[model samples]
Target: MPSQDEILAVILGGGRGSRLYPLTKMRSKPAVPMAGKYRLIDIPISNCINSEIFRIAILTQFNSVSLHRHIYRNYHFDNFHTGWVQIWAAEQTMQNADWYQGTADAVRKQLFEIIATRAKYVLILAGDHLYRMDYAAMARFHWEHNADITVAVQPVSKDEAHRFGILKRNPNFQLTEFAEKPHDPHLLEELVSRDDPQKPYLGSMGIYLFRTDVLVDLLNNYPLDDFGSHVIPQAITTHTVYGYDFTGYWEDIGTIRSFYETNLALTRPNPPFDFFDASAPIYGGTRFLPCSTVYDSKMKNVLLAEGCCIDHADIQDSIIGLRSQIASGVKIDKSIIMGADYYARTDQVDIGPIPMGIGQNCQIEGAIIDKNACIGKGVIIRSFPRGTDLDFDNWVVRDGIVVVPKSSILLDGTFIGPGSKD
Candidate 1:
């Protein structure tokens, strides 16, 4: 069996999260604020730390400044600890002048740096996913099976199977074939890897554990752009590939709707993914701020972070992020209020006409109020109808969810969503 030190973790910070735009417009996908306080990148990094696999490298390409800052401030290892986390951004080099084409290409460009780590196995992860797994267990599975590549898979229903890379495995759990988002019913029926009728087909989770030697060989020979689109299918034919079934809560929050729903889901009595685990706690930035203060507010099922002040507001089933300020008579429901990055200096009169937080008597529901947005007095923001996709000067309605972009200014009495006449 291989120890945790023998494996290296490579997290792919996806390229230009177009699906999660406006949020990804300013920061990288992983850097997007998640669950009120933590960034999406924190999930994978925290999992690695909890599993005692800390020699990690994140491959980033687009909009990475904020992502880089978060990593630098949160994940610094001490001198005594042998483990370290580093970022490998796409660059123009003498060998290659293009940006990362896809997942495999990103890793391929950084192959020399990865090879220098000299680890026996490489664990690849996607940064935009929400899940908790003991990767050390996966490593053990790979070692026990003597597998060249092991993909972490989850079962999807027949209807949902077409949206994923379906896998077929033999009785011994070794992968025999692969299908990339096959829509044909006959094809899906043939690819069922499990006995369950509801979710019989095994879908790839975009998580792969590769023998270092085998990964090097494949990348050198395949010259493919994507791992799911090209590499894994080819590896099934030439190398010993296996499937590791993971039966747990996993979500790919790569789009606005998924991200919105996932954030609000945390406000439930029992969230699908637990963050309160003491043994495997999710790590994040240590901002030494004062406790959140509320005054005569009616709140329920809300996840409130530090440095927030809610005054006479009615908030339910929402996530109020750090340094958030909600004035009196404000009502927020099923929304994600990503609070301001910094507090508005009260001492400075030069602060703009509209403050940096939600103003008095504002009504926000089923929306995502991004960081540093100033919602003036009596502003209204709500979810639009299904298939509602429109872009305004300061906000965007995507997938029926109204999103106020970062550092936007919604003037007093501004109307958005349903009843608004823009």
Candidate 2:
């Protein structure tokens, strides 16, 4: 039983997330924790669920164990008879090589499953971003225009515009040109209508709505490879690829700095992303825990999730993850602590300290520490997590990010510094 106008959505979650290094060293980018509470993939899934699209298949590869576990534990929906949210991992039986090479190839290999569903449109979206959108409305717009492909576009600043897949559209909303990370904005404006392009140049959100047969044929007979590299560029001239104007909050968390900034953006008094929307609620796995408690702590502008304990610590502009514990007199500012075992573990690879500290009396200066560090009392640790100058005289300077492996235990009274020994 299928509706004639139903569209299938495919969430692309196969990137190696190398830019989010250290953090992504163990977990996939989509599964990485965000705002100290939700995973990166939750944003898109919540959007899809809120949009009332029940049939979804998350395509994952490359360090997908954590991502798979996260979806299974939190977002599996079994209520709808025809709605099935499935996960498609790269299988050796289907491909002679490793995991998916690119976004287009990821879907092309599994085009059969999508075709079998008999959906009219196939929606492809990226899972590594922070945004709240009504995809259902976007889908309706696609049908309203009878477009071969409808891409979500938003306005970006001139300096940052070059980093995105900039779109050029006419008054009729048809895309005339598509360029990936172009250097010149004026040149990009050439593709736009003469009227007003620079003031509001369209940038692709990587959220595409493709006609089922069109997508199938493109995957079958298209001479090119990836979507951005081949598909969209080729389709612009031959097909009616319209640009759907979307004026919502969209942040691409491609690098560590961007990811950190996006998380901090949520701590604002009124965040752009309202996860509690009543009409389109972002669904998450149920957690049974009491809300966080702060006692004698000087905390400001921080987001504390349930099952957390903060005691006598100075915290500002930081995101505390689920069930994490911050000990008394421990001061943390401009840092991200994903796990809570920092104060109890003893096993660590110490090189030198630009900034590292521990113990009840330890005073830590400004710097980053990864996670799962054990510091004994009365030690001063700063942001410089590793000291590498001693080994090669070329210190592994702290990128202002302290990364500790998961569940690392620290012994009391141990002094470590800015770099890593391991």
Candidate 3:
């Protein structure tokens, strides 16, 4: 097994997550909050740390202020230990005047620094995925096979193959052909194996392992700007590329619907991705807050974080974030309420008619209330009656769920449902 010191992990923090919409309106995709308490970047960072790979770099470009702050404040290594996590934001220099054109381009821009690390292998990962992986095992697989590039792939359904890069591997797991989002059914069928017709296609997980020399040579020589789209296909013809099959829970939280579903899944009795694992725990910033106080509230299947003050309310299958303030007679179900940044002071005046947090008698269902939002009294956030998408003054109906933007205020008696008019 290769020592952790021989590998350098680089997490690719993606571009403006337009699919996640209003959530990414303020923060980068990787910096987006998840499970109430942790950021999306924390998943990969935590995994790398747990795998004993300490030297890491996060490559970010769009809306990186919050991402930078969270990384700087939380991750620190002692002088005695050489392990450290750092951020490599996009910059314009004489050599490279443009921003990161694509994933491959991002790494090319930072090639100088990457080569400086002097690591034997490079592990590239996506920042917005949710899963627990022991990368050391993948590294061992790569070494044992003597593969030039090893791509971590998962068996996805045939219907979903169109959304990801599909690959065909031989009996030895050596990648023979690669297709980026194939539209033709004939080509898709060719990618699948003859043995298992059910899971015919192997979708690339955007996780890659490469020998240091191979990675440097490919980036320096190829004009390709994307791995799945360009580099991987070309490499299959010349270099030895292998696919490592990963059978585990992995979800790319790229779209709003996926993000919403993933969060709600945490309320399940036994979620596929468990955060309660003692051996491989997720790490985040430690916020010193008082214990949550629930007064006369009827709650079930809720993951309430620290510093929450819940009054007489009914909550079920929800994830309440830190310092969430739930008032009396509020009924919440199948919702994710990201709590306020700080407590609303008694003397602090409201910026609008509604104060911060969910107001009294508000009935919210299948909704995602962003951080620091103010829901006024008697507000009803539910699906539209007419099943039509509506973007109101305070919220928007996305994937049939009410999404209240960060710091938005819904005025008193605001009723948003199907067929809401302007």
Using lDDT, give the best candidate's number.
1
TM-score per prediction, in order, is 0.99, 0.85, 0.97
In candidate 3, which residue ranges exceed 4 Å CA deviation? 349-352, 385-389
Report, for every candidate in turn, its global Cα lDDT versus the true structure.
Answer: 0.93, 0.71, 0.90
Instruction: Estimate the lDDT of model 2.
Output: 0.71
RMSD of 2: 5.0
- Per-residue CA lDDT of model 2 for 1-422, tens digit only, reads 33323878899985788777656767788888777667888888888877877778899887889789878787665554667678898776544366677899888878878989888888899989888888888887888898999999888666666787888888788898888988875786564433443445677888999999999888788756578768998889778899898888889888766776677667778877776678776665577777788899787877776777777888787776765666667776666666442233235555333212233654444423344444445644455533322221211123454444444444455444644452
Error of 2 at 73 (Å): 1.7
Off by over 4 Å in 1: none
Clashes of each: 0, 40, 3
For residue 311, what is the lDDT in candidate 3?
Answer: 99
Better of 1 and 3 by lDDT: 1
Which 10 consecutive residues of model 3 have the lowest summed lDDT? Answer: 383-392
Candidate 3: Cα lDDT at 8: 97
Tens digit of per-residue lDDT, candidate 1, span 272-305: 8899999998888889889999999999999999
